[model samples]
Target: MRVPTPRLSIPDEPSLALPRSFWKEFARKNWDREPRLFRGLFQAHFPTLEEMFAALVDASERCLRGEIPPMRAVRLYVEHEDGPGGIPYYSMLFPLNRNHLPVREDGNAHAYLERVTRWLGGKRFGVILNRAQCHHWGHWLQMRSFLSGFYETVGVPLAGADSAVFFGNYRYTPFGIHKDDWHIFYFVVEGKKTISLWPFEALSQREEVPKEPGFIHRAGAIHLRDKAEEERLLSQAQLLEGRAGDLMYWPDSYWHRAEPSEGLAVSASLGVAFRPPEFVGAVAPDGWPDRVRHTELPGGRDWRMPATLRTALQQRMGRKSLLALERERTTEWVRLLASGAMEGAAPVLTEAPLSPHEWLLGSPARPLVSFPLPEAQVLVSANGHSRAIPAPPAVRRRLEGLVERLNSGAPQQVEALEEAFFTRLTARAFSRRAFRELLDELVRWRAVRRCEPPASQRR
Candidate 1:
């Protein structure tokens, strides 16, 4: 029997603002073609508005505390007249230290925000936190979980995907009007925001103003300051508005800029780095040794091939003798899909190993990505990690059933699970010790987490 390549299984109850009508329209006419707004679908899925605001502040405070690990990119914006752009100014909001890193003072968010206000003489400020999918923070996890339904609806992107938070009170986007390389989905978690969009063929395009000295991000932007130019561009824009709990979709081909309604706001932007299908799929090895195998004698400047090699392309290209390479690639692709893999790699967090007694563990916010192999093994992927466990046919069925239950987001007693294992493997070679090891490894992989202590341990 041949096993087919696996695809991600969408959860029975998705966590996004997906309605049947929206999905139908998007799948039919709107997706990757034009901008459209879906109203009030994301309301029930996100945290409360107040809580969302607090999380942003806390993340900002952590950034100031230098607690942020290597981030993909964090853009802090404080709109003013000092930026290089003609009318609206947008630049990095955080003050930098001598080493050119954003600096923070020993203060809470209130104090920090107050200090910023005073320093800028009451200017508005905004910050963008790039979300890493596997981050332990509640908001980041929720956002990632919410977007999984999206990936399920639209096929997963191939090139790469990423997310970022947009928080600000600027009337106009300080960054100026520009186009992006990736299609964008914006979830309005806070106040209202509108985007003024124009077609890619808007004009011959103008050069962007040079960035302020010592400021980062001198991205290309279209000039709209000239009286005639401003009128022409404004006349052509297709304004799209989104309030709290709403979502907006726009293609990567449109030139766009933010046009906030008023006051403070925050939104989450998911970018699917969509690339043409022809460029996607597993790639071959590119190490120096592998490169030498294809190396030619260069028109008679011949030298013998290097010696220390046994089958120079072992499990690499996997086209010839390296049959295992294809299997590994399949396994890896399944695992990455299971973890909602994006451009940024997920980080493994710390978890204490499971002990030798009855314990409770359950931690899966969504469905598990798993496949049953012909070799009496079950491949399970959770939270961007995977493992294949060997068992008898009967045991494999039971194990897969157990994984499905865990995906329901409920904790089960390890003692009870062990009892089942004991019953199934009574005369088999598998042991209780091996079962415990498997559970502990799953915990370490962030696949499942430990529930709070049982009543007996509370004493």
Candidate 2:
């Protein structure tokens, strides 16, 4: 199914605050415009490039310290000079520790960083940290704050969002010619990246690129390796080059590939899924609210709607009415699919569990202590979905103080923290139990952990 190629917009005099009218126009006019692209969308909105680089480094350090789970949050890639296909290639399946830190049998974290730096000196090596907001400590707080402001400015209900940090110096892309399902706002923090985008219509007209399998929700690159084929496609491609502080946006399903033009580059990609207000009405029947209280979708994924609403609607609606609604919904989905606005993954709700340290805090005699996790924030519902929210001012101050203490590599006593908390904020501000619960919540969320004193200091 070929769709119209959307016009890419690059505004002059870029501003951090885009008028709400811009977003409204973008949705009204370009929502179904395949391969929607925009440049300088976040001008002067985020932290400076130097700050972003520092944040990436800080996040890496935290990962090395067994804070961020390496497997889930970090991906390492090494590009090979020569491959069987005579094309630039890279491997992403490199093994890492549970914290996603690179495995170094004989050396420490410093050694690991040095080894990586040396490896990337001549070879094409890259590191990608997913959910960077969760690990960059306070360095990325500005970026998170900017996103919150953007959400309010756009006035759209967001289903989910996340940020990934990419670091590498490479001339080749790992996956060639692919598309994403969610809208991506990409910021080039350092170095330069050249991206080539091709419309689906152009690819369909050529035989060089075979029809790949249908994509599910997950984002994966469709491998297209023939140089001659790439040349053919480039004839009709839209080329974009981004440097530090430049921001770009591309709607889902826009076939594109990116490669660094310099030795090293760092960029952040923010993916968002926006649900229109009319979506619920379009998908659910009139009595859906009363019909199903809670239900599960296929694959045991929890449906956001209540099962009772789903059950009641299923039972009350006639087959014909259901079929009619299904057809309408299908049409809507097709439009969304064409524009890359549909969500690819199911919404996940993770239950944070209290850490062992938090469990010990209840014991007045044990003197258990806790330290905040780097860049940790509580997830709060914004548009019916959980989003990262910064801690309240007082709580943030306390956590920051604790983080500073932990950074000193010294174990702190729980009673001392309690005293500090009481002194900083009045005792009436939070009851002892309430304070303990707050600490427990932070522990459960992996934003803090219990600390044990050194054996020499234990007595």
Candidate 3:
């Protein structure tokens, strides 16, 4: 018997095709405690496996045409078994480098693709797309709907959310057994893949773990390499067999590696890191706006404690400066929370452009995760981007009600949304204008999507 495919008509958490009862059981039994597999439960979520393949192909095509940095980061890895153990090697299918690192417009991406195509047959290869959220339009929409139910049940994950696409026919994980810090949920879109797991206690001394010098998938992981050790661990390992349309979950505590059956296997791994947010990149001193006055200090600044240097430093680190930086950092954190993903730590992908008259509704997954700031302003992030909107006491009250209406997951349309909170008698017409612009931004954020989703978004 199988769990019924969850339909949107159900009252609770319809976005994921999962019942609230199932999530409760998972939270109690398997979440961070053990590995669990749900067979054939997610086919509704991924109606067509071609979407995953298309995502990979699109990334490759983008690489071939020399697109953006996110596309340039897609790598084609080939499995090599000629060595003592099966390992992975770069196929160099898309070669773009600047300062010895892959970047846009630096090398001939097509030349390498042509050279590698002949040798790609028979030999199992993997197509890994980092920041896969940007590659396909369906990824974010489905995830947003799914995550809406997830975050409500699982609570907001600290690492936020991000996505990566793993497509390949590799029999075994090239990096061997490993563990990292993240709550990973893998959606098997095609074929079959199995995972062998061992808790932290099952491993040996740290010094005994062999390390590979190449760019292994996980930089900070213990890669086990002892045949005797492998055989011993397999005897007591818990196997999670994931077939097409299956959803697999394993906590970060377990050292696990995927072993796919002999065929093409594709999975989308949505990982939420178990770590603190990095604010350094989010708010940098060099990137301060022109509003922050910059002036060259006197050469006398070389002296022990020049007053001019002190003044300049104080100006850079003053109270206003600190608040500005804090807002930036807070917005970044809120952006991830609003976007409902920080999994791959990549930029959020915006929806296709929209006209002003386009109809829209709030995202079920992330209706509105906002933080109210002083001066009648509210900061909100949805789908993936963040913005600050004006909200006075009366407007803020009405906005809360609007959000409640949006969370209903109803087939809805927008009509004079600015009037929902702002009265026509109000003298501030520009506030209404900005509020209207905020609605447009919501479309871009995917916080609120078009009334009729594209055919790809249909269940």
lDDT scores of the candidates, listed in order: 0.56, 0.48, 0.55
Error of 3 at 37 (Å): 2.5
> Taking the candidates one at a time, how many backbone clashes does each contain?
1, 17, 7
What would you estimate as the lDDT of candidate 2?
0.48
Off by over 4 Å in 1: 1-14, 50-71, 83-86, 93-115, 132-153, 204-220, 223-228, 276-316, 319-332, 341-380, 386-412, 416-446, 449-459
**Can you give the lDDT of residue 68 in candidate 3?**
57
**By how many angstroms RMSD does model 1 differ from the true structure?**
11.4
lDDT, candidate 2, 112-229, per-residue tens? 4456667556566667766565544332333433343344444322233566777666564566677666567777776787778765554554444445664322254555556565
Off by over 4 Å in 2: 1-17, 28-45, 65-70, 97-117, 137-159, 204-220, 274-431, 434-459
Q: Name the 10 consecutive residues with the lowest summed lDDT in model 1.
A: 291-300
Question: How many clashes (backbone atoms < 3 Å, residues ≥3 apart in a chain or on different chains) does model 2 have?
Answer: 17
| Model 1: per-residue Cα lDDT over 1-459, one tens digit each | 111122223243224535556566676898767898878666454644444445455444455567774342455667776543346566674453322222234233344445555666777776666653333344445555555545556655544456666766666766668777667888787778998987665543344533355111112467666546665787889988888877888887677888756766777777765442211234423331211111211111112222312133233444544445534544554454455545433445466666645455544433455565434666766655677777677767666666655554545677777776567465565667777877777777656667765666665
Flag the better candidate by lDDT, 2 or 3.
3
lDDT of 3 by residue, 16-99 (tens): 546677777778888878878887666355624566555655565566566656444576566655643333433434453221
TM-score leader: 3
Clashing pairs in 3: 148-365, 161-341, 161-342, 161-343, 162-343, 162-344, 339-383
- For candidate 3, the lDDT comes to 0.55
Clashing pairs in 1: 339-384
